[model samples]
Target: MAVALLVALTAWAFIFYVNMIDEVHDSIDDGLDNSKLLIIHQANLDSTVLAKQSFDEGNYAIRKIEGHHALNHYDVYKDTLMYMENEDDLEPVRLLTTVFEASENEFYQLKVISSMVEEDDLIEDLFYSLLWLYLILIVTILAINTVVLRSMWKPFFKFLNHLSEFKLGKNEQVQLLKSNVAEFKLLNKVIADVLESNIRSFHNQKQLIENASHELQTPLAIALNKLQLLAENPELSEEVVNEVFQTIETLQRLTRLNKSLLLLSKIENKQFLNEETIDFNDLIKSLLLDFKELIEFKELEVIFKKEDDLKVKMNPELARILITNLIKNAIRHNFNKGKIELLITNSSFQISNSGSDKELDSTKVFQRFQKESTDQSSTGLGLAIAKSIVDISGYRIEYAYSNSMHQFTVKFD
Candidate 1:
């Protein structure tokens, strides 16, 4: 807008300056033409006036000329410089030379001079005036627009501020502000409806997961107890005991799956809001002690190196679960006599373990029930739960495979 304004003002200033200069010249020329006529009349009335060949006292001079010199001659006006006796400096003047008849067959060349205007001074003054006008116009326009736009969008800014403060599933109500604009009013209504629907669905889904997990726990516990009793019976044959143990294992897997789903739901709902500083180095050390027997059973080479203590502020329970899941995932998918590497730094915790030579699907690695290995005992929710915990805590988790090792790195905020 400023650029366009500048272009328009410049074109106008140019045209105005040209016309003003032309008007000034025209006014000066008119005065000179009137003076020429008066001087010719005086030369005819007084012969001494025509005898003067140069201007000595007045601004006019008349000289006698031959008839041929006056032939085909036209009146001419031009600019010239003349020395001022009083100021002792050259001053600009206008000259009008014309041939006029003092008597019959007697021609006189009349030269009339007048003070000329200083065009350089005029141009400078005009440029300054136009510059000030441009600046004043820009400032006035910006001031008016600032006030107008602020008032115009007041309701929109208010609506956005209110919307930003809303949280879903917290039972907090959304407060929609009134707006005069039709579009903002419609937007407010539609967004309020969508948020209400989402909150309703969230509560329903949360209730269903909690109720299902709770209802299944009692029967699963009873079934597991009965299966364990059958396996312990002395009268049972070896094949029957094996089948019962398999059934118990399957039921336990189901139980783990149920618990995992509940945990994931809680994480996504941000239920674990309690936070405290946790030292990851100590957590990893305790977890490794708890899994010592399993590590020995697989004959896995364990290497734990603590370059620095990793301290992060997060939910203690979530921190424990996040690290535990990664450890279990590493052990569960590892090959016999494989190597497990744990490296803890000030900002991150990494676990790398030897597994299948082929890389797991990175895109689906953290998805629910994405089994990448042939471990039938695996529930396949370990990595998914870990990912959910990390997301809720605003931490970062990454997976990479190199040198036949499946590596999981969790970086703390």
Candidate 2:
């Protein structure tokens, strides 16, 4: 802006300076015309003296010439350079020439000279004055724009800073001041609406999880307890006892599947907000110990390796469920006397088990109910639950199969 304005002002100043100089010359020429008339009158009255006089100090001169030269004469004015006794360099002057007739009828050419040094000085002064004015105006406008524009945008900058750091999961509600500016007012209203809708959705999901835990799981628990008591009856036959046990197992499986689905929903909805410091190494050892009976029944080779304790800040319940699912999936998919391996390090946890030689699809493996094994006892939701926990806890899980071995790796950072 400054450069463009300066350029425009400079061009205008140059044109104005030129016009002013031309106006000055025009005024000088008018004076010269008046002098021309007076000289003609003086020559008519005192021709000999007027013709004999030399030009000096804005004066006139009459030079005698042939009649043919007088016929060819025309009035003309021009600027010329001439050396003067008072100045070392050649000085500029304006010259006017025209043919005239004296009292004796003799032809002569009248020439007029006018000094232009003062006109040049005047133009220089005008240019400097205009340039100074342009500079002063430019500086003043810039200072005004900086102060005024910054003050006007202060409210907007404040709103932007708060909005960028806004957290939806936090207990605190978003608060924004109403703005007088139309655009800013619109922005604030739109943001408020979106945040309100998100809060509403979060509350709805929380209510659903709470209801399922209370209303559904409670009745299922009672039924399982009743089934257990019925199975313990002394009068029951062997077949009756077996049937009772099968019914209890089916109820238990149903209960677990319901619980897993509810847990997946809760994790996705961000319901487990509490966090605590837990040692993953200790957790893994305890899970392995819990499943020792299953490993023994299958005559599986269990290998465990870990470097040191891995401490992480997370929801203890969710972490336990995540690791439990991984271990359970490895066990359910393995063959009798299968080789099971657990490798734990500071950065990662890996679990591998002996299975079929064919590889499972990696894309479908993490999805719910996705499977390659035909095991009847497997729920197929184990990997999905593990994946949900991994996502919510901000960890990564990967799966691979090679050399008739299925492997699942969990990375914790």
Candidate number with greatest lDDT:
1
lDDT of 2 by residue, 47-93 (tens): 56454545655367778888888888888988888667678778988
What is the TM-score (0 to 1) of candidate 2?
0.62
Compared with the true structure, what per-residue lDDT tens digits does model 1 show for residues 247-272?
A: 99999999988888888988898767
CA lDDT scores, all candidates in order? 0.86, 0.82
- Compute the lDDT for candidate 2: 0.82
Q: What lDDT score goes with residue 196 in model 1?
A: 79
Clashing pairs in 2: none
True-structure lDDT of candidate 1: 0.86
What candidate 2 gets wrong by more than 4 Å, as runs, is 1-172, 233-240, 276-279, 296-313, 343-347, 402-404
Clashes per candidate (backbone, < 3 Å): 0, 0
